[model samples]
Target: MLNIVLYEPEIPANTGNIGRTCVATNTRLHLIEPLGFRLDEKSLKRAGMDYWKDLNVQTYIDYNDFLERNPGAKIYMATTKAQKVYTEVEYEPDCYIMFGKESAGIPEEILVHHKDTCVRIPMMGEIRSLNLGNSVAVVLYEALRQNEFAGMNLEGHLHELNWE
Candidate 1:
């Protein structure tokens, strides 16, 4: 399973939606401390619907705490400052993909220390960044695709109907 790390995520809806994605993709979610909103917020529950409970989620007091628990784990930080594109690296199973908060991205110290593991999505438009949920989906799906969609269902749910 892949690990999705949200470092101080600000928005409830984004986290909730990401939780849903994790549950659907059989991925693990790790949240760093000082969250912007409460985990039980209505917005979060609404966005996640009933799938939030199924998500394999964990929380850390801080970056150091996370590091202490998962020592030697391959962590790829998603940041705009990275020179390498997300797809440039070969993603391995159980690798941790981390995204920062909406207002501020990952800390400079962490980025500098793990410079080789930092990556970014290519943005062609004038927009500064993509939505948190969208960004996660983009990178996570690419990783899943690279792994040939392991542990995921490929067939359409309504295939028996033959709608086409």
Candidate 2:
């Protein structure tokens, strides 16, 4: 399964939607702290997030905390400054794909160390970037697609309904 890492995400709804995506893909969601919102039951209810409980989520105190816990993780950083396209890389099934904050993106301090692993989603010249949630889906789905959508159902069935 792929792991999606959000470094200091600032939006609650984005996280909630990412949590839902994690659930749907059977992926893990890792959140580094200085988070913008709480994860308490009341907060989840306020966000109308029902499947959060089903999400395989983890929280880290900071970047070092996350590195200490998941040592040797095959991490790929997503950023606009990257030369490599997301699809060009061969993602391991257990690789960790990280996205930076909505405003600044992963600090150059961190990305500097992982230059070879940095990737970008191609976009028009006028656009600054895609939505955080959409960006995650784009990169993540590429990883998942590379993995042949493993352990996921490829087909959908219609519910039973008849009209005269």
Candidate 3:
């Protein structure tokens, strides 16, 4: 099971979108506090729609609290400052992929210590970063793909017709 952590997320809509993605992918969503918007914000509910209730989500007081609760967890910090591309690492089944707030992103203090696990998505000239929700999807999907999408359905069929 993969985990998606949003560190100090400021945008309600982005959090909602991330929540929906997490549900679809059977991943857990963790939110680190100092949030800019309330969890009950209308925009979040609207973006998440009916999926919000089913989301496997949790809240943490801070980074320290998260680390204490999830000991020995292999976490991959997603940041533009990372030296390696996100695809370079061979993600494990239970790895945690954390994205920073839309504004400043994860503090350099944290990234400095976790240099080995830091990763970034490739971007073209002048673009500072990708949208928070989009970035999560990009990295999460890659990890899922590498794991052969375990325990996930790989095909679909029409209700009234057969492939034969």
The best candidate in terms of lDDT? 3
Taking the tens digit of each residue's C-alpha lDDT, what string does model 1 give over 1-164? Answer: 99999999999999999999999999999999899998989999888889998989999999999999999999999999999999999899889999999998899988998899899999987777899999999999999999999978998765457558
Per-candidate TM-scores read 0.94, 0.93, 0.95
Q: Candidate 3, after superposition: displacement of residue 109 in Å?
A: 0.3
lDDT against the true structure, each candidate: 0.93, 0.91, 0.95
Rank order by lDDT, top first? Answer: 3, 1, 2
Off by over 4 Å in 2: 41-48, 159-164
How are the candidates ranked when ordered by TM-score, highest leading? 3, 1, 2
For model 2, name the residue pairs that clash: none
Write model 3 residue lDDT over 48-135, tens digit each, in one string. Answer: 8889999999999999999999999999999999999999999999999999999989999999989999999999998999999999
Q: How does candidate 2 fare on TM-score? A: 0.93
Clashing pairs in 1: none
lDDT of 2 by residue, 1-164 (tens): 89999999888878888888898899999999988888773654344377887899999999999999999999999999898999999999999999998988999999999999999999988787899989999999999999999999999999988876
Query: How far out, in Å, is residue 58 in model 1?
Result: 0.1
lDDT of 3: 0.95
Task: Name the candidate, 1 or 2, with the larger lDDT value.
Answer: 1
